[model samples]
Target: MYVAVKGGEKAIDAAHAWLAEERRGDTSVAELSIAQIREQLALAVNRVMAEGSLYDPDLAALAIKQARGDLIEAIFLIRAYRTTLPRFGATLPVETAEMACDRRISATFKDAPGGQVLGPTFDYTHRLLDFKLAAEGEAPVAPTREASQEATPHITTFLKQEGVIQTEVDQGDTPRDLTREPLELPADRALRLQSLTRGDEGFVLGMAYSTQRGYARNHAFVGELRIGTCAVEMEIPELGFAIEVGELELTECETVNQFTGSKTEPPQFTRGYGLVFGQSERKSISMALVDRALRWEELGEDNMGAPARDAEFVLYHADNIQATGFLEHIKLPHYVDFQSELELVRKLRAEAEENLASAAANTVPEAAE
Candidate 1:
């Protein structure tokens, strides 16, 4: 007779209280405010917003704090919260070029129309730990970069002038959201990028690094990496016009990759694109590289069967939230299945032992006879 396990209600309540305590940590230490998390842990908040597909920095920060700095948990919280939030309407395509540039730069050109403004990058900073920061010392003043009136056009656009790079038609179409929909194989550019943005940063970086190191050698140049706030516009049919809804921080990366001429087409340099939430340059760059690698088949290139080249491989495995949730869920109870397996093994062993004994007895009797 099997008895159903009870005490889940009490266990759950107790766990909730204990989790609250754990999240709070030391009783004497001052509790972390959502604002403090939002301001102090801005980058974490940014990553959560980007990956979570939610735009609210404050809520992301709060989730981070609530999750005790577990970024994946924070992302999960943001995703869950976003589901309940009322959707006013879909926003028009964000003009990233027209963004209020916080950080903008071009590697392809020495000087672009919008001159390279290396804004808020850790690129040149020494990797040494500061003793003063250990005690929460005052931060250095923000350095001002002079803004340029002449808008710099995208480097890829310039390459397209001579028919060097693949020209993309601005579908100006609606892009898909991977968070809301289940990811299917053979994804479009928009869907692939969405998966990569919320993807395991380390995994994406390694795959991108692999392409650079010759797993699928696609020579790529970083045409541009831009980070800034862009206004989100939404059209209201009732009002008969699109209005500025709000602004969001975006990190956009454009890469130029080498491509061979197709049988029916002339040789051309191909373009790979990546756009992420917050200032996720690493993710964006990695995404661009992977994006280029995936397009090899479409461009009529040879099949190298690289990790990045496999759409089913990259898209299916990139999501850390899904990976971790499934991986970590094994810790939950499955004793019934375990016991069943144990019983089957025991039964099999007993039958094998009986057979062996019978064979031995028969052999001994035959020899005696």
Candidate 2:
């Protein structure tokens, strides 16, 4: 058993007390409610849910509160909690085609079948601070237009019809889950997408940016970006039929990238797909960019020694919890290793001084002679 040092228990208790006090800065000030975080800070909650791989908004809000608004910490908490829960069964893949879209947009065509619907985005908003929101008074609800009922078709369908883009093929194989199995090199598309979905958003964004800055540049264009609720279905073997299990909000991005045909194939466009939980468009888009870059092998493109193209490098470092744990562990006791290093440095210095003294002694005797 690992033994605690002297006063370790007392120090831990004191540290916890200090942390609690710090969490609540002033008694006079109203405590930030979980409901406020769930509703007002919905974006943060959505991100936590996305990265944590758990879709419970209330629990995510609670985790956020417990973490004192540290999003990565909240995600870690949720992920830890999620591991304890018993799994019932796996649900069938949700269909994006039947999505009840709140926001749908395409960049390839200005006037596509389903016109670009900018639902609730900060895209066109000015970055000016709204100081009025600082007051506690509630603001009036803004009226919203009725959402279109027409089923929105994917923008890539147009290219597929003309044989300009590669048609999506189903290999009919269960994707290897990174959470359950060790990550293998040269990961398949499904495994790669899974990693990117749960990857650290900032790291994925950086990798994507590198690709755009001429590191295995793929000339990617946002073919379509859709945010909506999709129904999850599960096939019950006993019943011999599928039933709707639940609905979940998803943000899906499809990037159409430039592709030159191989010897056996004709010139066509390839695609990179990203689907993340909730309204995480930035993460989804970044996932798509990285996804495309990692496809250099299948696409017959040269490995330009790009960071994004290195599947092993990207997947290994994209996990925040793992990164944080390893990074923060440096604070723990390293006395033995540190002492060894210190001794080595001292020995090197002593050896240098002794050599210098011997050299001086020899030179003085020669000069005297």
Candidate 3:
């Protein structure tokens, strides 16, 4: 029979009280509201929603507050809460062509149909800190222009028409949901993208960076990267038609990689794709690179033993919740294991000394004889 340690409830309660105090340091300062967090820390809220697989900004803000600004903890909270809600039906595939794009850029083309709209970006800004913002100085209004209403054609489509890029043949198959099912090896492109979308932003970024450093170099160029809102629609069984459920912000990245033609095919530019919830451009870009790296078999490219090329490794280590749980569990009581190890070491040392002493005694006797 084994007896476990107790007082978890009492310790947890006290810890919670201490945490609340720490969260609101300096009583004279005003307490932050969920609304303020939603509005002021919009980027943080967006990240939580993106990684959590939940799009509710309000709930994400609340989770952030409850977690005391730990983004991973907030994401875990959102994911846990999301699992409890009853799933009715899935929406149809979102149409990016009809997206109300706010920010769109293409590196492959000098100019695209809608042109490069660098909306709300930190690009070209100096990294020097402005001390004027310390006093909450008023900022100048940003210049704006009316956006074009024309449907933005994908940059890859242009290459496809020119016969310079490989056309992806759509194999009509329902994509597996990672949220509902256990991740299996040799995942399809859809499953790999899903994992990458919900994967840790830093981890994915590192993996992508490693590829550039020659782990599995795929000469990649950003074909197109767009950030905007797309309408979601779901088919109603009774109504016999699809209706607009809601609109969500999305960041989509498409990478054009140079693929040397195999025996069966001609040389062409292949593609790697990423679509993530909210304006997570960095994550989306990294996802595309990692996605292409993992598709070695499909692309007829050498694996080159890259970490990012391993689907099993990337998917398994992607989840922050799983990583945190396994990592943090090491802090738990290991007295029994430690004691067993201690005893074994002591026994080994004692046996070694006894053997040495016996050998010395036998040597002395032999010499005297």
Best by TM-score: 2
- Model 1, 54-155: lDDT tens digits are 888899998998899999999989888888988666778887767777778888888776677888889998989879998998899986665443344677
Any idea what lDDT model 1 has?
A: 0.84
Could you tell me the TM-score of candidate 2? 0.94
| Candidate structures ordered by TM-score, highest first | 2, 3, 1
Q: Give the best candidate by lDDT.
A: 3
Q: Tens digits of per-residue lDDT for model 3 on 211-269? A: 88899986799999998888899999999999999999899999999988876667998
Query: Candidate 2 vs. truth: CA RMSD?
Result: 2.7
Alpha-carbon deviation at 163 in model 1, angstroms: 1.5
Model 3 TM-score? 0.93
RMSD of each candidate? 2.9, 2.7, 2.7
Error of 2 at 347 (Å): 1.6
Residue-pair clashes, model 1: 2
> What local lDDT score does residue 303 receive in model 1, on the 0 to 100 scale?
66
Off by over 4 Å in 3: 1-6, 146-148, 362-369
Q: Lowest lDDT 10-mer window, candidate 3?
A: 142-151
- Residue 253 CA displacement from its true place in model 2, Å: 0.3
